[model samples]
Target: MADQYAHSGEDKRPTETPAIRWEEPPEGPVLVLLDQTRLPAEEMELVCTDASALVEAIRSLAVRGAPLLGIAGAYGVALAAVRGFDVDEAAAALAGARPTAVNLAVGVRRALGAYRAALAEGGDGRRAAEAALAAARALHREDAEASARMAGHGLALLDELLPAGGHRVLTHCNTGALVSGGEGTAFAVALAAHRAGRLRRLWVDETRPLLQGARLTAYEAARSGMAYTLLTDNAAGSLFAAGEVDAVLIGADRIAADGSVANKVGSYPLAVLARYHHVPFIVVAPVTTVDPDTPDGASIEVEQRAGHEVTEITAPQASVAGAGGGIAVAPLGTQAYNPAFDVTPPELVTAIVTEEGVVSPVTSEALAELCARARRTTAR
Candidate 1:
């Protein structure tokens, strides 16, 4: 994909295409999302008029990422309210659609709260729906602001940690404009560095069993004109050994109170590598990604996906689809371990950069204080 770049002075700062948007059609309100599953090959939008369709999109990863999931969940609730579905039931289903990302539930409850509040004040169903839509819009705008703030904080931290300037950053999974209301978590930080001329190369880890880095992150990098190279997940160790990596940046699905990060499956290994190589391993996410109710990594639920995702290989070069749209790579009846995400212990992480601030040493106290400060600020 990088080879296809037309270096003719094109603006490479990631197109301002939204991953999700709330639309009010003549028929009713609908949630429109870019179909992420068809990425790097096709730019398709999934227009969902009901909660069930939105749930399917979430489960199938058509709309993903922690921050984006929150935004989508809020919009899902608003869609239900406007369409006259039972708001509580719709919120429940949307929240449960993907349990690993706490942001989904958080976003759902926020909009649901607004709807209930408006209804309690004697508003009609339509008025309540309007309140829900307003809440969803607020969450959406907040997420975009959080993304921008996180990018600023993360880039400053990178400069502080690696003062020599040009940085070779290694990233796992996808975190860019496609994943958030604004430029995404870790990738947004990298993008900031690139824009500042401080980024040398971005080593994208081809996250196995999913290839999110190869298919999504690489696509975003190519469009942004970032100097990037794609490599197998295992090859990161070689890069670390050769001192080719200055830092490892990644986004989290859920961050526990103890500052343990639950991110894509390969993130833990990269954290271990970064620790071994004495490189800065930073987690960039909004404060909403932190779950204070979850005490530690052991308490975070790791989602287990279907074995077929691991047992089969799906590539654009494939001639034909197998039984379930992917050509089988493993022998028939073979079992595979396919955990959707892995938890990285706080000790392995050098810092957690959020829109609120940076949590260095990543202690429980630091995380709590950051969240507390953010709450107070928001209250004001």
Candidate 2:
């Protein structure tokens, strides 16, 4: 609990804000999050005093990104324990808030395990709660460390794959300091390239139904002083056709045993375009995102969000009267197919970059070995 919002290494950009932090106020401990929905327009903090509030924040995506979800889930359990709530119930609610991200359940289990283990060892409720908080803090620290390692590995892979110094990278959705304890997954790699003067231009896709890339990724890029341009999601094909893209980098919500990646909804299409264009389609994530229990891509359960997310435009400031949260863009009662994420098969992925290393020619055996290596390192 020493540095609740500590990021690893020197501060490269002083203007960046942390997406999540744990704070102890006079009344009780709370999980404070920078409300992402209001990003690029206004900065607001949402303080969650209980697990239920945190659950809503997760469902609403006030705090998101797979790695950050795991960290927030662990802290949610700690908040419940420290507040004298039923730890088991809190863990279940937090883990179940979002189904697609494996990291959420994993984080909840880790904190709950520590709490239970302490209680079983004849420790009182106070001691057990302390153990839970400590577990959450440890996880936060580990994720920051993982983020830094991932950036290093991912940047190296970029350099090796595209020996040309100046790299033009295209990215879908949002992955940055706003999404991780450190810089972030795919975005972190691009940032590393920018720092090394190898980044020529960052082409951002305005991911539809949400526009995370336009709002969030673009915000981070500008804050970091990186040269970037925003484009509609559909325009990616034109960029690929013109050969303006050197590579495509994306972050994963969940990685199945066979190396299939479940990222934001538009990620799979980018992978396909990258494949057709003969560009490297790289996935950058921590080892924790990989789930050995999911046998293949088809087996991975993708979360289906409400249709209104597609039929209507919702923003923190755009509260015009409409069927959904914002102004309605489609006809009244119009149905929409809105899956929060899409799966990209391993065959299309050029490489998978994790804190441990990079895996080219992605296969189940290689992915499993990477996960095993991470587990062994953690155990030691």
Candidate 3:
């Protein structure tokens, strides 16, 4: 199974591909995405000529990851404005595509606001559209810079927590260049450790139901020439018991004001295990992921996916009828409870790493201060 999903024994970094980009065709501007659903086996691009197409792409997981979703959302609005579509309608649809990631809504609103401001200042339709595009580009650039700074701060935190040189880190889901404009959140720190020769091994969780870890993280690890091993999500306990894991790192989808983090479904379990073992479980994300309006974990909404994703498995090599596609793994009418994300309370989290800095012993007061500082900086 690992052989099927990863290119093991490869020691060279793979060529980087921009996960999302704006393309100008003679017809009009479109949003282009590297289809993540068809990854590891096929490299394909999905072109979105309108807001509806982009919405379907988000829903289908053709383009994913929290940071990348924001970039795609802002660009979607820009595409709409440049193509003479209803700007307000486009912003509403794009922002609604995914509710779990606050960055998506934030990006859409920033671009929409820029467009509205320019129009109110006596700018024509074309000038307003240009303002929206400029806003989207600015957001894109800022995300890339944030990724870099987050990597630096996270690595520093790792060094402080673990005085010893060689580190064995465990991570969940997919956080790499495929997920953000720069390297990534948690994964970027790991990459930095590898470059500094401080990394011993990267234990990857084969995030189930979607296998984002197996198909995506492993792919990235191999490409970057990192010493990594793919394991079933349940196998992590054995590693902790054996004293093989030194820390746990993961990226967040949404972080509430109280510092609770919502991430991939399997992440909360890892956090629990890390806490029990006295290992540092770090949550890494950009400041944009923090939602001050969300008072606590209970207030955040988790997106539930379709039952088919859990009930069926896709194997391209099976010979049985329909087995090569989405073969059924359960009863036809069986109901599967599939929540796309799970929240980890701040108490379980050892620290939260953002582009600004690290918040250890995560508390409501500490998180609130960080958010306030970020707002003050942004206002300038």
Candidate 4:
């Protein structure tokens, strides 16, 4: 059994795996990620002692997910300052690692803002580091709460849309305990439904290039004792064709002002499939995933990945160097185009569930009203 931790032992989370880490870090500004590459097997932390190392972790996906990346980036700045590296250089390096990730930029800018303010006040590096860590922790706490609220709102929407007793939801990539500060974004909602006796079975897409769903998400489902089955990315269409899915719930990397969501590669295709199958396609993410400044999907830059992810499939549990334990699924020397994420148009998106509530379609007026209502609720 995966080691269990205690929260309030709250009814909100009624699973063997409690909410992941509700306490603050013992050491300030250190990046500790549950090494995701190893799942359904070993749970390990990739602890970083410095900024550059943290950057490598993000680049290598030792740590990932937009919200998690934001938290890690903030800590990276703090780590840089703590280790005597120039804060500006740290911000530059961290922000430059992933160009398309809005969270990375948000985290870097937040830390940079704190560092500048502290410098202006003639504070030492220690105090500045403390401030940076404080920002990251605040983000972390807020994200956890957002996860809960989003799950509630999303589950409600699911109940209304499907109105069926048992729901089989299709999701791509890993968006669960390993992806966020807590339960997760999309999977959190599905897990919520499971707790409420609504979830039938979860369809885990073996996300290609990384297999996050096959490896990480499935591990979480198994631990939580949720009925889950994993299949290759290509098999999702078959499931939808057979009417196995009632809805599609996935987390977003970024949502433009026009509500064009960017998620893991192959998400756009699922959106198309859902539309054809008359399934309710929904996106569940925190308010942090939205970028009001970015106008549309056309403006969101899609990141191209390395050829290796396409050329070979490594055993998720293999530790040996050059382990062919995973087969070479793709042809050798064939140039491959791998975009880290694909943009889903608003027209295809059925609704967007945030911590506040569900937003209908994608429109400036509707989203603004939804956001305003959310702010009012938060204020209370």
What is candidate 1's TM-score against the reference?
0.95
**Root-mean-square deviation of every model:** 4.2, 3.7, 4.1, 4.8
> Which digits, one per residue and each the tens of the lDDT, describe model 3 over residues 1-380?
00012222233343355678887878778787877776776666777888888888888887888998888888888888998999899899889887899989988988999999999999999999999999999999999999999989989999999989699999999999888888888999999999999999999999988899998899889888899999999999999999999999999999998999999999999999998999999999998999999999999999999887888876323443332257788877888899999999999999999998999888889988998898898889
Instruction: Candidate 4: give the clashing pairs.
Output: none
Q: Local distance difference test, per candidate?
A: 0.89, 0.89, 0.87, 0.78
lDDT of 1 by residue, 163-220 (tens): 9999999999999988888889999999999999999999999999879999999989
Q: Please rank every candidate by TM-score, starting with the best.
A: 2, 1, 3, 4
User: Candidate 4 regions off by >4 Å?
Assistant: 1-29, 317-327, 369-380
Over 4 Å off in model 2, which ranges?
A: 1-16
Q: Tens-digit lDDT track for model 4 on 1-380?
A: 02221223222222233222223365543455555555545555566666787778778776788877777777778778766789899899998888777888888888778877887799887888777767766777777788888899999999999886698999999787666776788999999999999999999998988888887788778767799899889999999999899999999998888889999998999999999999999998877678878889999988888877777677645643322344666666677788999999999999999887788866766776776776687679
Q: Residue by residue across 159-226, what tens digits does model 2's lDDT show?
A: 99999779999999998988888889999999999999999999999898888998899988988899
TM-score of each: 0.95, 0.96, 0.94, 0.88
TM-score, structure 2 vs. true: 0.96
lDDT (Cα) of model 4: 0.78
- Candidate 3 lDDT at 158 equals 92
